[model samples]
Target: MFVNFRRIRKCQCVQLITTCLVLSLMMVCWEQLDNSVVSHVKSYSYRYLVNRYTFINKSFTIPREEAQSFSNFLYLLDHPNKCKGQDVLLLLFVKTSPENTERRKAIRSTWGNETYIRNTLGVTVKVVFVLGAPMTKPEQLLWNKRAGLGLQGELLREDLLNGDLIQQDFVDSFHNLTLKLIMQFHWAHIRCPHADFIMTADDDIFVHMPNLVHYLQDMARKGVMDFWIGHVHRGAPPIRSKDSKYYVPFEMYQWSSYPDYTAGAGYVVSRDVADKIYQATLTLNASIYIDDVFMGICANAMGVSPQEHVYFSGEGKAPYHLCIYDQMMTSHGHIEDIYHLWKVATHPQVKQRTSGLAGRLYCTAVKLALLCQPYHFNTYPCKAAFL
Candidate 1:
């Protein structure tokens, strides 16, 4: 009986010791978690608060008419082999206006040519021009009625002759450009969510299809996920001047500086991020006139910061030189300059002469000279290296 009693005591002792050790380990883990929280708070910037406050104060009310805007909004409008029976590497969505036929044509001929991008670069690509009709107007009421311009069940019957239009019924004006972006993402989520990456560019920007493809291919090899990359703007202050088009009053946002965002001129999002951003669009206050700022808001909700690439010029023209052209991705403000830039960028002499390391050295020297000269460098962010 004494031996049995001693055995019981030993068992109880072991149990007590195990319990004490587990409790100590848990306390240690909790201390580490508390320290991490302190570190996070110490590094907090106003940009972090901007995201939280904006999300917390989200005014995500969709009017009955607007709620109906998502259905049959963008049915296969000229998507070349849109990941059906194949894997699509990239899907490019270009935001275009209703009357910009010339811009669309120029884009189709130049970098927007899906066939050219695929054939030359050997990757599956699809391009779609996103469009929406202006708000229902009085004199144009009959035309709007015929075109099925709203949630009145006529949205699917609209006729677009060329078949490249991803038309929705929302008003396509500057005030509603953010809606345009929202509609684009919604369509992609429903139509092409399997795309490896989705890119959005303004109709005015010039996309260097070859360079972009190669860069993305390299990323694919590295197995990147949750990606967003562009010319990132960090710690940009809001335009409080009421006269400015980008004005944001204290009522709209209380933050001193806006969150980091890529310029609306052009940007890219990975496939998973597209769905997340689309859902974010529904939950955030998107009344901000600047589309990119709104995009930053959505991206922040998903904890994604855009990776910066210096070659992706933000609201500026990339410097015009063979070396710059060789590594450039997209240059903003390029409507009339699109075709000329394409020709210059893809010149035969460029291929024959500047083929390797020696060419890079010569171009780097020339770029240094331009930078040191003072006149051109001040106006342009000239650099020869590909980022």
Candidate 2:
């Protein structure tokens, strides 16, 4: 009787264990099924919404372009050896007004100055400013006065260190900005196509040349080409309100959202795509107010896409943290902040730092807190959001 009772208890224990194992397997299967259903719903909903949005805003127009000629715009006065030598690493172009001589001076003294870059970083850099022809004698006088040259300044300043300016024959006005942009690409396409990389920035920007050089080297080593990189804006809608400075009329561009484009303030491109974009400019609409968006349209027509980088601040300055500033490549709208920014960025104490994991973490948290700060911060007016 005792043996039979023991056998019955063993059988009951085995049945209980088997039941628990089956129950656990069933729960796992149920959870997976639930998750799969949820994922499917989300995927379908996203696709549907995106399709609907695009369908609603679909727009197109045939540009009434005549036999466009960029050759008529060549009013170059001083053509420097844009690249130091045959093996030029970067051809940096700064877009400036004919009268923005102070900004140009500040740039040459700071980031745009290539002497320090070549001497210290061992990278060949060429700095050139792109401008359009001045309308009147006073405008010409202003340019020559600020640039410190005579009436034959263009001819005489050929050998001058700071004479690396390219002034095309187009009327120098805000409306002619697109012509100015295309002219740069055309100059690059014909004059300096063999350059490894090219960059375009505004006169008011503060560029950390050392950081930019390192970034370019990495891209070159990785064999990156057809490259267009900066602070990319995706699906940015046109400013329809007439009161705004960026207002775009429907007659100009019917599309609601402009194609993805890097900010015009500063961007980098490889040799492979420079010519392609120059060709694109010949056919794409050239009447857009914003030069960056116009370039974006040209790029889109050629099926080339813009790559986004956090370091390139578009239309804004980056928040001033030591680590953040050290890593940033470009910041915008620094009209008067250029000198101050250069001082802080190149400070010796900020350069030599020994930080462990904890230090990095602490700085990152602090930056995050600052990044999400409410309105009325430096990030505003400067557009200093972390890219």
Candidate 3:
């Protein structure tokens, strides 16, 4: 072939420039790439292939003296008798903020209503709100003192009216979620130890009382122990970026992957597991602010593995359908529509639609279409359609 040296040189230059550009782009995007891909790979490898997390116990443990500083908050609002004298099946601790009165109200009227749960479901499910002190921004602290007082007074009145509030003295903020987690276990241990199961959930989460109660009743009948179930997050890597809210410092948790944990949006544990978690909190360094991840560490220390329940949502709302409602255990991120969703989800038609062979087949196909998607919806996994 007749070739021109000049054209060949031009092509070589173009190739060199393209390769250099690609290299530079990769270098620039390396951190993101690590966060999205490399970190997960490392996490999964550490979680599954290597398969040992015993070191987490020693690494995360602090002296009991040091641990007390995190959990030794005074209870500002408490009802010691809330679960007393009742044969409580489930002690639900809904983590809420001091200012979320409307959320509490909605929950009480809907899923968290002990009265409705007793009358309709014929179960003694005790629902209580866990919270810390109302805090204001540093700059506004002085001016907001009065506002804080008003909020406090309102919380007291609300608690008196509902008799379901459990408050502590620590400042209520995102970083204090671990404290709230500690509070739940600690309070449950002290006040409601007789309950068959304990559940920790967010205020925004909606629990299908009928489904959850039935599940717990079965587990109780089977005499289940060390039982923990939720939307399992297996081999989840920590976010290393400083800007991210979920970022874990290398000094705090140097591990590549966390111990398997359920989504903190909602999860359930048997009475024994709750005691194990309470003991874990007493020794483990509660510095990890992400409550769910901390729960994973605690559970890992106590040798309680989280079981995956496909119907338990992580961070997304379940699909709005009768098939979903029929089998749904929990759905996260509910706020304004909580009352409406509660009414619809608990309607008798949901059970009717999923009852017989024809209904079962119809729902199976409908769920397969809704749940088995190419992309994750964060509510239920694709395999949920089969169940």
lDDT of all the models against the reference?
0.72, 0.72, 0.91
In order of TM-score, best first, we have 3, 2, 1
Best TM-score among the predictions, by candidate number: 3
Provide the clash count, candidate 3.
Answer: 0
- The candidate maximizing lDDT is 3
User: Which should have the higher lDDT, number 2 or number 3?
Assistant: 3
- For all predictions, the C-alpha RMSD in Å is 20.2, 16.5, 3.4
RMSD of 3: 3.4
For each candidate in turn, the TM-score is: 0.74, 0.75, 0.91
* Model 3 CA lDDT for position 27: 87
Off by over 4 Å in 2: 1-67, 78-81, 137-161, 374-387
Which pairs of residues clash in candidate 3, taking residues 3 or more apart in a chain or in different chains?
none
Better of 1 and 3 by lDDT: 3
Better of 1 and 2 by TM-score: 2
Tell me the tens digit of each residue's lDDT in model 3 across 1-387: 998999999999999999999999998899578667988999989988886788888888889999888888899999899888989999999999987889999998888888888998898999999999888667766648544888899998898888899999998889999999999999999999999999999999999999999988999999999899999988999988898989889998888899999999999999999999999999989988999999999999988999999999999988899999998999999999898999899999889879999998998999999998888677998889878
